[model samples]
Target: MTTTAPAPAEAPASRVMAVPPAPAADAAAYFAARLAFHTDVADVHAALAAGAGDFAVVDSRSTGAWDQGRVPGAVHLPTAQIPRLARQFLDPAVPVVVYCWGPGCDGATRAALALARLGYRVKEMLGGIEYWIREGYAVETADGTRQLPPDPLTAPVGTDDCGC
Candidate 1:
């Protein structure tokens, strides 16, 4: 026996429960929130290199993971340490950008929320350090600094950026 796809009109309504997309105004609001809450690795690298000290970059991984490698200038502020140690190391006035291992992890989100609750402005780096390294950005380690070629699956292999 063979099966074929249903015609759009013939498809059951229950099988096509798609909601209309957000209106322009709603979409605008959504994009604004997205821009406000997320920053990508490339932009973070540019901002750090330009010395835009308006925000602090923080790594929210454990000490052992941190010792493995980290964004060069990121502060080692593990999520568990935030309440007890945020004030001592972070300035509430400066906005913060936090990252953890990668997309598979929520440590960055938890850290961002914690810092926000402590009255610090915060944004979570979307791809975290994994994407940072995947995109061929340098990471600081106990041995010094290292960078790997961009994983083509994660970033354009060469020739300028992805042109986004």
Candidate 2:
């Protein structure tokens, strides 16, 4: 049997598209630092699963927000609480990956700063719990663990993975 595929959808509009490529050295340094400062949900999940990244995942939302949902095993270090309390839950030598509600929020960045000030290496999880749940990753709430179907717009809809 033969199957026909539908036409591809048009790309969405944006004010800024890809910029001209930078020089090789500049590009390399930028991306290397980008990786150093930021990670996405999938990579964080893989790293956590391997159990060897030597990084702590910190949820930098408020107590109410954390209680709403959070990455299982994530340290509940709210940004406001980090300066006074990060050392209580994090190792100085270990790196940290911090997240808040989603890309729309900057609480993770503030928390990262606080952790860094205290001398913990840090990276911010780019998409936060928003994309975690969007990509069907497990989250632990007071009630229990849960996940949702991946949104077709953000994730591959008909396959096990996007193969990216």
**Candidate 2: tens digits of C-alpha lDDT, residues 1-164:** 99999889989766565565689999999999899999998888877777856788999998898888899899999898898888789888889999999989988998889888888899999899998888877889999997788888777776755776
Candidate 2 accuracy as TM-score: 0.84
* Alpha carbon lDDT of each predicted model: 0.91, 0.87
lDDT at position 63, candidate 2: 88
Q: What lDDT score goes with residue 22 in model 1?
A: 85
The number of clashing residue pairs in model 2 is 0
Give the range where candidate 1 is weakest over 10 consecutive residues by summed lDDT.
11-20
Candidate 1 structure quality by residue, lDDT tens digits, 24-121: 99999999999899999988987888888899999999999999899998899999999999999898899999999999999999999999999998
What's the lDDT for candidate 2? Answer: 0.87
Model 1: how far is 113 from its true place, Å? Answer: 0.8
Candidate 1 positional error at 53, Å: 1.5
